[model samples]
Target: MRFTLSALALILTVAASSMTAGQSTSGQPPVTFTKDVAPIFQNNCQVCHRPGSIAPMSLLTYEDARPWARSIKQKVLAREMPPWFIDKNVGVQHFANDRSLGDRDVQTISAWVDAGAPEGNPADMPPPRQFPAAEVWQIGQPDVVVSLPKDYIVPAKAPDRWPDILVDPHLTEDRYIKAVQIIPTKGFTVIHHIRTSIVEPTDATLGSGKLDDADVPLEVGEQGVFLNEYAIGKQGDVFPDGSGRMIKAGTKINFQMHLHATGKEDTPTNVMLGLKFYPKGYTPNHAINSTTVSAREVDIRPHTDNVRSDGYLTLKKAARLLSFQPHMHNRGKAECLEAIYPSGKVETLSCASFRFNWHLNYVYADDVAPLLPAGTVLHSIMWHNNSASNPFNPDPDAQITYGQRTIDEMASAWISWYFMSDQDLKKEMDARHAAKTVPTSTR
Candidate 1:
């Protein structure tokens, strides 16, 4: 009787093993490219994944994408490729071109990869979408195109150098702008980042009328106001609803270019800003406000894996957030950006998964505006790497601080917003339309 019982137990174990294997292999339905995977890629990845885009590869077609099927599946499942830095569980924030993939979308792509990446029926395939040409300005035509007067040379043998350049596009009278776009004329390799500022003439003797000379020297931080700042892998600021900062007459635009030499000698770069103007009597709906967080001095022990630097800022009043941009340099360990509201509702603005090369400004859509009440505290946590494996590490032994160079590190989160009241926005618009001078330094 004991022998019979042992045999029966072995038989049942074999049956269970077979059933598990069958369920694993046969239970999942097959996924198709035309129906499942294509839609996801088209929606999320195609913006930067198309031909001639900044992305390393393309995912426009099944044939072009088939080779990377497994890679796509893995990266999406790992949540690394779409490059979003937000924690969705806290609050719903929708970006203009949101790359966040849903669980269902990920599952569909994974199943499609497992099903041998089948090309579904041609009739069911969606129409192929066309991508805009590279280097083409998105807003059709610009009203004013300002380029560097002369090419600036980048010294060879300098791995990373930050150069502050003054580009004087002298205008006669004050000009109101709606949208601004930056176009890199040359030296794409060495030019890693550019920060543009508007400099108003402090000296009345310098010029009152339109200046004909291109090389005009204007004080940067003296009397004029700083308009907007832009960086690499990001678009220039656009005040679509007539909300951009004004450039007063006799002001010059300063282009502070940050170049990474990359061991090459003497690179020359020229940059241009294409400006779009709003029609007369138009006013912008929103204004942009930025809060910068940095770590200039912090004790980091050698050989430590995750050295952290923290900073916090509390909002004095309520504001409607329009967009967010997170900045970090090489050797950056990790970062968490979030806001704690007055009511204790915490919203995760962005949480980057430790990559310094892919820094970008995340722009949100209209439907999901992250509203911050008064007494909200914005928190930032930055990490650093002082190890040998880091390629961009300037010195593993020495301490680093906040600077423009790649060797030195920085942590900054810039948030842009419009005023809360529609009536106030309209009032500002009416004043701007009348060409009435409202104090730009009010903020």
Candidate 2:
């Protein structure tokens, strides 16, 4: 959570009020804007709900929120605001950036709406929050900013397009990158998502680093190292100190964009990516590895609900896991990550209530990172709902298969982790070589 200490205190204050009709304890005042609602909005909703943000309306102050009081109550009653869909009962509840409203907070909003959404006193409002300007980078400025070689035009009325363009940064030597941000010059409505990675031009024939229409076929079971991803509500992340990903010199950066055409006229868009590197000559104590656990041969039968697909990753060495991003297209229902230790102990890392529209990367809070020794197996299971009840279902009767289009389905989770030491890295490399000779099942 990006909430300040003072904002957290306000949350505690509202939570202290009884859930029963949002009433305060004896001798306390009723739930009011200054005392109750504004703080909750400030902490949870204001990130996207403020002016010039993605949300349709603003809820920053009493004047801004008063008109939408009843509407807010409706949305909260339906559990629609704040946009987090992770089931509280399933996953690790104490996430570092949890934006979900607590049950008591919901009840307080309900009670406030029931009580006419009163503005009890202007004096009780907390100090206004400070939001960064739109042009400013969320994690300060990046060391390098690379844009597309040329703008790509997206038709307004045609089907979606995945423009995979290759851009070369022309780095002379290796560098350790600490953070990255994906900035889309086009409006958000037309852009679905973007995935960026370093593509090694092993092919001597493919010489020029120019835009190519041919889709780069990713090898099966091949985990291409990714730099970053752009999705709704996603912000740039700074890796923990003494940790970063190593980027080699002369490597080509591939921009795999998933662009959706808004129902307007044709438009052109240019996207720029910003990269921040660690200090020159600085070596990271731990190197982060991003690998995808995928069940790409998905064949969801028509009208299937909760159809399960499984994938697994075996740790060849000791690793400290940082985050997991479960990804799927429409019809995706839920995703779970479990660790099967060498000693046979199974720990559930996360079992989130997944939504296709919200591609969330759940970063474990500090002191919560799980350490998996060699021979440990991590399992990924994703559930899909393709029945008529799924409003986002593109075709209820069509058998869904793995594809890049929005209509097609995908079942996968991106794993982010770091090897514990040099010995561990060597052990992992040896295990990978051994695995090449001995095939294993990932189910």
Candidate 3:
């Protein structure tokens, strides 16, 4: 009886050991590339962290990402890597390709790093993601490319200088454009501000064809319509349908290049404009338009801090806001943008601790889907620095006003919106397409 009991016990012990070994081999968590980490980087960090992206490092490959796994975990946990400025819990702002990491994602990554970043099970790895080549236009090939006829020289000096140069690209016939993009060629060191305007042929009196060589600069007149405005290292503004200021047939595009002689002579500068035409048969669902919601001019009192300027624009009727871009030069302290709907619900658009060098066009996903009824008000609040410690402060001792030169200050916000009704959008799109169909008239 004793011998039989001993044999049974030995058999039971062997069976238990076999089961434990099987569980260890089969139940180990697989470090899947797609199911685990690739999706995290693709959704949260790819926009700026991919190859040739603005971010300092690339996380596109397992090898490339392995080295930065610890850094990624640390930065994400600290809420610094993604650079999101809004309070995510309170507002519903979402970027088209957002890099903001959630708590669970961060934890998973940290655990993966602790588990040796194992490239476990090669079959579970995802296929490599295809990234677009750099310099390729996001909106496809442009129909017309307009560049400066010649390079303009900029002098070496400390004080800000505004050079109003005329770039006349004389087109023989009328052309309808759907989108326009500006690319800077040179003068990055000295350039501080630029405003491009369309000068109709009939409005020759608006600007003399000859360059403004005189040391005494001419102020931008009130009647002049701004085609586009840009600062250093900023993305080109894209005007929606019927949103751009028109350049009539035989008209010349004029540029007001604001070159701030940063105490050093800069290489000659040139700018290029890529124009995209409306598609042949497709009708646009909405026409894009821009309106300022902040004060046009601001006066920052000397020796003081946190000078605030608030501006609001009430919509005459309901409209769907597609996207918005906020603009502010150096000395910008802080900014908060929001929209108050007719239902008394306030939608927080964006809030950021202002970083002057990094200007981004925050594109929303799904047009925000907010039905801003009649009497909805869009609001923007901008804070400025007028203290001695502000590094970009041109004149901390003097009051500032809205001006083109970098030394002089300005406070303005531009929001681009698509019209309310789908029918109205379709009409504008059809008109644009029809205009393109007409035969070119060479007069």
Q: What TM-score should be assigned to candidate 3?
A: 0.58
- Evaluate residue 245 in candidate 2 and report its C-alpha lDDT on the 0 to 100 scale: 80
- Cα error, residue 166 of model 3, in Å, equals 6.2
Runs off by more than 4 Å, candidate 3: 1-87, 90-92, 97-130, 135-138, 150-166, 171-176, 179-272, 279-286, 302-304, 340-349, 367-369, 386-399, 421-443
Clashing pairs in 1: 85-350, 85-351, 156-265, 156-266, 241-284, 242-284, 243-284, 333-383
Report the lDDT tens digits of candidate 2 across residue range 94-195.
555667788878878888987778998899999987865434567668988888888888887877667778899887787888988887776555666788
Model 3 worst lDDT window (10 residues): 210-219
- TM-score of each prediction: 0.67, 0.77, 0.58
Reference-based lDDT, each prediction: 0.61, 0.72, 0.58
Inter-residue clash pairs, candidate 3: 44-99
Candidate 3 residue lDDT tens string, 252-341: 666766555544455587777767756544445554444446565788788777888877777765565555555566777667777776
By TM-score, the candidates rank as: 2, 1, 3
Question: lDDT: which is higher, 1 or 3?
Answer: 1
Which predicted model would earn the best TM-score?
A: 2
At residue 22, candidate 3 shows an lDDT of: 22
